[model samples]
Target: MPFKTLLFSKQDTIAVITLNRPPMNALNSKVYKELGKVIDELNEDSSVKVVIVTGAGEKAFAAGADITEMVNLSTTEMHEFCLISQDAYNKFEQLNKPTIAAINGLALGGGCELAMTCDFRLASENARFGQPEINLGIIPGGGGTQRLPRLIGLARAKELLYLGDMIDAVTAEKYGLVNKVVKQSELMNEAMAMAKKLASKPAVAMKVLKNTVNNGVEMNITSATNFETNSFLVTFSSEDRLEGMKALLEKRKPNFSDK
Candidate 1:
């Protein structure tokens, strides 16, 4: 399908979704819907081992939500709109496959929330991030309040949200907001390179690993370990496991079937 606000393409096992609106790709209802569609495709397609989300241009990953639309929204309308966007983000987070957020530039407010939803975050040296929603007399309604704390720490999350200050890429990386920061020119190359590396690994194992790691964080330690152990056992029962073992025995690279 043709996308209105984003570009979706696959290379080998990586699916890249570029937020196509120029300058800073601010989120809109259309953008959210388009993203939701692509996210759904990533979830259902076995060939898609990883997904990379980024903005089209160098200005921003996403500046924030479309505040122009927000001006007209009543409290109820605002809730509905935020829910739509949050639902898309929730879908992205729940995806069994791994996802990497390519923070190309300024990732503020809902933009920051979007990146936090992903499994990993890689930022360009020119990137910036923050939850600057309070300046507008509002709080982030799109999972920021909850996710930021979990990502960094409660104190750090509170400091960022309370002050609504934007931080540089390097600072963000130090605080655990971003995974790594590279030169602007190397941004896409680095993201795709990492995606390719992850794609080369056993796809089914990555899915199971991602699920156990992500879900385990919310559960107690004992339950989480049990869940992970169960996943370990489950993988050994798969065709990919057999191939991985046989390939090791034959002294060759394993070719996974994602089964």
Candidate 2:
């Protein structure tokens, strides 16, 4: 299906979704709906091994949610809007294939949360990040409150949320909010290269690895280890696992079928 708020394209096994509201790509109800649809399409497409999400313009990945649309909304309407946004973001978080956020510019409020939903983020040197809802007399309605602390730390997350201050890409990298920062011209290239590398790995193992890390982080060490053990055991029955071992011994690249 065609999208009004997003531009989707696939290059080999790598898929890219660009937020297309130009000037600032502010998130609104329509954008959320379109995003949810796009995520569903991508999730069902087996050929897409990796996904990259970014903004359309040079100024912002998404500056924030659409304030004009929110300013006049009643309490109940705002709550419904937030729920939609959360659902869209949750889809990204639960996707089986790995996702990379190419943060080309400002990532504030919902923008920040959107990037956090991805498996990891790679930012341009000019990119900026923050959860600035406090300035609007509200809190992050997206997953910011939860994911931010998990990605960075409680203290640092509090500082950004409470102060509503934007941090530079270098500072964001230092806080562990972003995996790496590169020149603006190199941001997409870097993301594409990383995505392709991840795509070339054993697909089943990669999915298991992501699940283990994501689920394990919230569990106690023993429980997490047990979960990892079970996941590891399940992989033993996969054809890719056998091929991987055989290729290692044969001194050739493994041709994983993602079985």
Global Cα RMSD, each model: 1.2, 0.8
* Tens-digit per-residue lDDT, 1-259, candidate 1: 5898998888887888998878889998888888888788777888788899999888999999998888999999988898889989999998878899999889999899999999999999999999999999989989999999999999999999999999999999999999999999998899999999898888778888888888899999999989989999988888999999999999999988778
Q: Which regions in candidate 2 have their CA more than 4 angstroms from the true location?
A: none
TM-scores across all candidates? 0.97, 0.98
lDDT of 2 by residue, 1-259 (tens): 6889999999999999999998999999999999999899888998989999999989999999999999999999999999999999999998888999999899999999999999989999999999999998999999999999999999999999999999999999999999999999999999999999999988888888888888898999999999999999878889999999999999999899999
Give per-residue lDDT, candidate 2, residue 242: 98
Residue 42 in candidate 2, Cα distance off native in Å: 1.3
Clash list (residue pairs), candidate 2: none
Give the number of the best model, judged by TM-score. 2
TM-score of 1: 0.97
**What local distance difference test score does each model get?**
0.90, 0.94
